[model samples]
Target: MFKAVINVNYKPSVLDPQAEAIHKALGRLGDDNIATVMVGKYFELTLNAPTIEAANDQVERICDQLLANVNMETYRFTVTPLQGATA
Candidate 1:
């Protein structure tokens, strides 16, 4: 078994409205050090496959198809075997 951890975030060049709002709110609260915030998505996927390579391939397909918006969002992930589990 394999577990995939996926994270998707906005492109740096794009402006984040939610972050700007929070930054302004922090300023009002006298927290000027708060520069910005980026909102993102996190996902954990479990797959039963013969090998890590196969599982990773499946994970990539899923991310490209659904988890990430290929135009605006970028995603990264890691694949690791489940601890103490039989294959």
Candidate 2:
């Protein structure tokens, strides 16, 4: 078994409305030091596969094909096996 951690975030150049709103709220709260904020998604999945290499490949494909939009969003992931687990 393996654990996959996926993180998705918007590009820096793109404006994030949610971040903007939070920034504004922070300013109202007397926190003007903040300049910008970005919102993103995180996914943690436990998968059962034969090998870590193959499982990682499959997870990457899933992220590219479905979890994230290649054109607008960027995604990165890490895979770790459970204790005493082979592959």
Per-candidate local distance difference test:
0.89, 0.89
RMSD versus native structure for model 1:
1.3
Q: Taking the tens digit of each residue's C-alpha lDDT, what string does model 1 give over 47-74?
A: 8988999998999999899999878889
Model 2: CA > 4 A from native: 84-87
TM-scores for all candidates: the values are 0.89, 0.89
Q: What lDDT tens digits, residue by residue, belong to model 2 across residues 40-79? A: 9999988888888988998999999999988888999999
Off by over 4 Å in 1: none
Candidate 2: count of backbone clashes, pairs at least 3 residues apart or interchain: 0
